[model samples]
Target: MANSLHDTYLTGLKNAHALEAQAIQLLSRQLERIENYPDHAMMIRTHLAESEAQQKRLEAILERHGTSHSMLKDFMTSLSGNLAALAHAPMQDEILKNTFANYAFEHFEIAAYRSLIALAEEAGDSQAIPLLRESLAEEEKTAEMIGAVIEKTTLEYARREAAGQTAGI
Candidate 1:
């Protein structure tokens, strides 16, 4: 039973690692398109670096357990994130859409880290708790930042629309 619990915990870490990699790709694409919104672009760029560091931390955790991340899952998630970002590229409210998606994704990551922390505790993996907690805190902060900006982005979109600065459709 303990072995099974450890395996589950490892799986959770791998999933979180893959999701962070996907976030890197997602944020990179969004950053490229958010040139119109310098604040948003800078925040995304900063988070992209954070995501990379988080991935490294996850790799360290998995290495200590004698396992590694799932390459196939990472590839699939990265592709999906990139595609999702592109889907909003031509839309008039691309910034708003990206902000909403980013907020949701950050929350998803926070939940994953929280679950991983619980699993680590159950498995008596004291070494993993701090690492997981760090990532969880970062995810929560990013989610809060995105949430705080949503209203501003929405208002900016309205202003742009009124001024005929946005795309027609």
Candidate 2:
């Protein structure tokens, strides 16, 4: 017999976990692509190293849960390909795009880690807690990095805009 809505509990949490896995995979590759982009002054190499470790951890987590990596692989392929295609963008456009993309990706990662932490706690997956915490810390760092760039770039643009306004009027 098919299960009714009332018969299921914690269904959303499962979906959330699945989404987290996929988001992490996508973000890892996207960050890797940007790490190689010129003019990116952040410590992306170090982050990429950590990201590789984190990806292995995710693989372990999925394997432990008997889940396939197909979904995450698909998502990562699309996301990384899209980011790579922007490699030739003009400096200004690329900077803005990278900043915005990183910001959004960090938010997604933060949310993903938070969800994983909560789910692990609720499900008594104590071993997964540390993994989620480490991931959360990295996501926070990523957010800070993006904010630093956005602040500097936005200020410079704002100054130029103000200067142009004064010159016109």
Candidate 3:
């Protein structure tokens, strides 16, 4: 049972690592397209840095366990992230669409991290607990930040659209 739990913890760590890779791709793509929303861009930039750090932390945890992240998983997830961002690129309401998608993405990460934390606790991984919790807190904070601006973002886009301006960043 203990061995099974340890395996599960490692799998969770790998999934979290891949998730961070996807996040980096998504945030970088969004940052490049954000011309009208400096505030939103700044927020993405901040979280991008945090996501990179979180990836490194996950790598360290995996290393301590005598393994590393799945290269295939990382590659596939990153590709999907890029594709998801591309899907939003051509929309007239790109900013609004991205805002909604990002909020959902943040919540997804929050749920994943919470599950990872639980796995870590069950696996008796005291060392990994702190790192997992740190990532979890960051996810929660980012989610809250995104949630706070949803209405304002929608309104900004509407105002721009109504004024005959390019509002989709």
Candidate 4:
């Protein structure tokens, strides 16, 4: 993930395509979670909407090079759907499985966007650089907001669970 675009400009473009293919899966999972989990729907609405747009953006990036419409896209989308469905599972984990999933996913997305942006800049793809940068901005904001939510809810959930256990005891 060092993103060394040293050799050819096409190397950078290929890297970006790979990132898009990856993102398409991640976003699909998030979207499905938004649809299935009524509890998180409102809270994650903004991010979901942005993610929808992000799907389009990523696809456009791939389509720019005619690489978006590939088998990789379908595979990634299926994988992401499976993963996203798990987001709404019972609050089994101490931190809330969904919250952990969201955080881990956002972090992954942030890295993907960062890589794409760096490669876009390095390759001198002026159009792509701005588009990638814009997506990166949204990804950053989404990650920051999700991080805040996780921080706020984590301790509260832990304390409540602890209190419930004590009462039961």
> Each model's TM-score, in the order given?
0.96, 0.62, 0.98, 0.66
Check candidate 4 and list the clashing pairs.
none
Ten-residue stretch with the least lDDT total in model 1: 160-169
* Cα RMSDs, all models: 1.6, 7.0, 0.6, 5.7
| TM-score comparison, 2 vs 3, better candidate | 3
Q: State, as a TM-score between 0 and 1, how close model 1 is to the true structure.
A: 0.96
lDDT of 2 by residue, 1-169 (tens): 1233211213323434444444444444445455323334344445556555666666666666665345564466456535543452434344456567657866876886787677667666677779778878987987787777776666544565576632100
lDDT of 3: 0.93
Question: How far does residue 85 in candidate 1 sit from its true spot (Å)?
Answer: 0.8
Show model 3 residue runs off by greater than 4 Å. none
| Ten contiguous residues minimizing lDDT sum, candidate 2 | 1-10
Which residue runs does candidate 2 get wrong by more than 4 Å? 1-41, 71-92, 155-169
Model 2 lDDT on a 0 to 1 scale: 0.56
Task: Rate residue 157 of model 2 by lDDT.
Answer: 48
Model 4, 1-169: lDDT tens per residue?
3334434344544444444445445444544533323434454666666665765766676567555444564566556546554545443442356666666767877787777677667666677777777777887887777677775566656665676642100
Instruction: State the number of backbone clashes in model 2.
Output: 0
Ordered by TM-score, highest first, the candidates read 3, 1, 4, 2
Q: Tell me how candidate 1 scores on lDDT.
A: 0.87
**Superposed model 4: Cα runs more than 4 Å off:** 1-40, 87-91, 159-169
lDDT of 3 at 13: 90
